[model samples]
Target chain A: MKIGIFFCLKVWNMNAKIAIQGIKGSFHHQVAQEYYYQNVEVDECLSFEELIDSLMSGKSDQAVMAIENSIAGPIIPNYALIDKNNLHIIGEHYLDIHQNFMALKGQKIEDILEVHSHPMALLQCMEFLKKYPNIKLVEDKDTAETARRIHQNQLKGIAAIASKTASEMYDLVILAPEIQTINNNMTRFVIINKADNFVSKNEINRASIKFELDHKRGSLAAVLNVMSDCKLNLTKIQSLPKIETPWKYSFFVDVTFEKYEDYAKAKALLTIMAEYFKVLGEYKNTKP
Target chain B: MKIGIFFCLKVWNMNAKIAIQGIKGSFHHQVAQEYYYQNVEVDECLSFEELIDSLMSGKSDQAVMAIENSIAGPIIPNYALIDKNNLHIIGEHYLDIHQNFMALKGQKIEDILEVHSHPMALLQCMEFLKKYPNIKLVEDKDTAETARRIHQNQLKGIAAIASKTASEMYDLVILAPEIQTINNNMTRFVIINKADNFVSKNEINRASIKFELDHKRGSLAAVLNVMSDCKLNLTKIQSLPKIETPWKYSFFVDVTFEKYEDYAKAKALLTIMAEYFKVLGEYKNTKP
Candidate 1:
């Protein structure tokens, strides 16, 4: 009977429509495929705002958004978007980002005169690109989209810093592989959905939370102390200025705990301590 | 005698060569000019890395770089750049950013087919641009450079979102004024110089610091408690992952205080409590 119930749950999740921030062969698309065990429908979005819209409007059952990268750090605007839209992060996946230099199959590295990619991709691969001072670097909207455009337009003397998947999908040859400045490039993507989606309590060991504190001395420290006393491990903390109220900030944190009771205890205490508090998500710890 | 000393100081500062990340009319240029009262040589660099090279090689006496914007939050990589270079921040300036839409005199807003600017500028003015759905939004290297290009090429039906100074320098007419989503947009810039240039103790009230805490529970909280006890106001806090060590983080914080002794006390305490500590800058608090 237990096996039958688990099979049913998996079958139900198989039909989820996942919204992503870019077209096929993009990192978002890659995450969607690797994260779900079964085949899922993908609703391609050209931007994060559109991805949120698709989820909110019921066009897609869930969304995958890149929240942070090891090198580039957090994507602040996306945090605001998830908070403002009341979206919940159900899970997260870390992708080993390998930026490859690709162009038309017949072209060599020396033939490239210009390289196009997303600004972050260009920044990550700056050390390698610096060796060729003569090549002009152009910023584009997407990494894979640039590769697709190059192939479709039959462009010459142009290269793209993208993923190996993009090269295969676009029928281009990768001139150089894993050209990022740091070999250990990783991007953390969060799986998000509407607030109503529920996960089993026993499966949750991590949470994303946001809160605001009063202008008291060591107010943040006090809240953090509460988290520590409850045996919660603070993995990440980011403070974003409340735009309307210049100096005031709202803190977003990710924490993991061995017991749900400990998180519950901390939540109760934080609710009383903070002027405003909200749980952005409760999910299984990807790292733990 | 006092007036004569002041006049000599001003004359000495007049010949100082300043390095900025973009050409004249960019926001960096605006800060460079407004921060100094007299004429100074400007060494334009296309990238932040180049800007650092100019400063390190003694090609420029000082450098001006934007640290944070009210709308977009912090520029993380720049923080790493400043910390890694061992540069000193002698002063700071707050520029009220006004993104104006400009084009050739004859073209109307409806006549423009494409708008080009830095990605951050485009994001700041996104609310205004959404109305013109027909116009293509293109990201370029620099806002002022895009305006100059449109002027130099006499490109018809092209608009650029840049500073008011850019319009005047490139002879472009403003199609719309103050087009940023927020009317009170502000960007904080830091004036950096070699470590040997020092500001008097009485003039210093703010500091930018970087430190790393051990893995002990409540280590961060303990450090914050020390800062609070020393009467320091934590204006900003950002955590950057130590790239080499996956889970460990190095914190960058900005603090302000009423007395220099309080800051010194906190620095001493943090030095003892943290595994590693460094002061990125000691300058007057621009906001305070």
Candidate 2:
């Protein structure tokens, strides 16, 4: 924002562009709305690849990606995409995912013989789906788009799992309001920029890294032992297939190098540690 | 085999019954196909909840649940169901998910104005979907059923992200084979039996646990510190909404709990830690 402001004042040649995936009414669009002002210029991409490509080619200033949903552990491919694309993780945000059971207006819950939702929504509402065993569980691309279908199909025996906003958008009734099984559902999204938006003075010992080792016996265990030796707590570890090296694997680890060690000490430990491993990227934990 | 032969010689008795979600052509049904043979009398449940209920009531000898997908991460709600129902994890299996892009016969890719799929499948092909930005994405309950509609409606402009088996089942043409964004995609399925399958043999280093903590500042941090002190390697931690307990939070943790340590050692740690925690359950980790 500082550089953008500078260019705006000095030469009036810059705009803070935000890149997101999907059309309007998609969750990515909703997150962009939350952060970026309405009417803010957003370079919408049809997919994550395009968004990453635009971010790489300087077509967009920054890109927002969904990291995980309450119903899904992590968007695994997105993680690999960010890693493969070498996009820096600058900031993180959370969104409350409220899923509604929707249908065409005047259609009661009993009238619905099938329920459609994003696979994750249906997965999250696994328990609710059981109540209507006769009704089928279908996966849709976007939650809001599911609502659009029930309206378009004009079928009284079908309903959708979507946000409350979608219900009004398509004039659909809330068939089984708040059908998502877990009430405290949330999704974590990351804002990425090519320029450095990390390096926080409030850095609380959090680090993100990617590593690919010679696939051999005890390779992962030996690497994990080093972290335990330093008493660094490992928060998460997810494996993405070796895109560059066929039949191999890469692992992403998020850890908090002890606060007592200070930033310099933490950096030193990670630096020496990188000799035997690959250090992907490090960002301050932005979670409040 | 010896026991079965003896039982056959003595008298006929009931066989083991297993329950799973989805009808034919669905991924769950395919994943369940791995175990649905011989002694396993597989029963189709319309929803995941029924699968769980069957396991809980001893109506089914076991239940199969998909925990995670390779392209996607872990299935979030299935974890919640596994935690809520008092079922023990006995084994784990992986299913390679192949999503094929299908359309009615004689339809071409250029003619596709709409794409239908389960939400997960659509999300996976998001990169491909971007090219057809004008094409509407329809969320349907069953990928196979969507294919069935394309053939029935003769909607030349419509395509469905389904499985190869589904296209064969519906006699549809493959507009784009292996339409998923990622290759080598797979899903993790867990077989949950009601009985405690804890054994006296084999490496028991893995343990699955769920806990509720007082919704307070640093509650999660404090729990992490405890696990760290025990030298327990935390692999995955997911937060599930404590719907029954307002404002309280529950977490599911998979960890390497030192296999050499007896059950008492692990249980004692959780017990001593219970004043500030709720120990949901302790079972073997099927992943390792």
The candidate 2 chain A region of ten consecutive residues with least summed lDDT is A1-10
Please, what are the lDDT tens digits per residue for candidate 1 over residues A1-288?
323433554687767789998778989899988876435589988778779989999999888999988887888889988998999987888998999999998999999999999988999898899899888999998899999999999999999999999999999999999999987778889989897345667777999999998888789888988999999988888788777566678898989999999999999999999999999998878762
Q: Chain A of candidate 1 scores what in TM-score? A: 0.94
Q: Residues B1-288, candidate 2: write the lDDT tens digits.
A: 323432442354346666876545667667666644433456766557667877788787777787766665566667767765767765566777788888988888888888887666787677678777787887655576678777778778889998887788788999888867677677667767676533232545556677765534344455556565566766555555455332234567666665545444545676665443333334445442
Candidate 1: residue pairs that collide? none
Per-residue alpha-carbon lDDT of candidate 2 for residues A77-187, written as tens digits (9 for 90 to 100)? 787777667677765667877778888878887777877666667777766887777787765556776677778778688888887777887888886777777776777
Give TM-scores for every candidate, taking all chains together and pairing residue i with residue i: 0.95, 0.70
**Which regions of candidate 1 fall more than 4 Å away from where they truly are?**
A1-10, A13-15, A37-39, B1-10
Query: C-alpha displacement of B251 in model 2, angstroms?
Result: 6.4
Give the docking tier of candidate 1: medium
Cα deviation at A92, candidate 2, in Å, is 2.5
Task: List the pairs of residues colliding in candidate 2.
Answer: A138-B141, A139-B118, A139-B119, A140-B119
What is the C-alpha DockQ of each candidate?
Answer: 0.62, 0.18
Candidate 1 residue lDDT tens string, B100-194: 99999899998999999998899889889988989888889889998999999999999999999999999999999999988767888998888
Instruction: Give the fraction of true interface contacts kept by model 1.
Output: 0.45
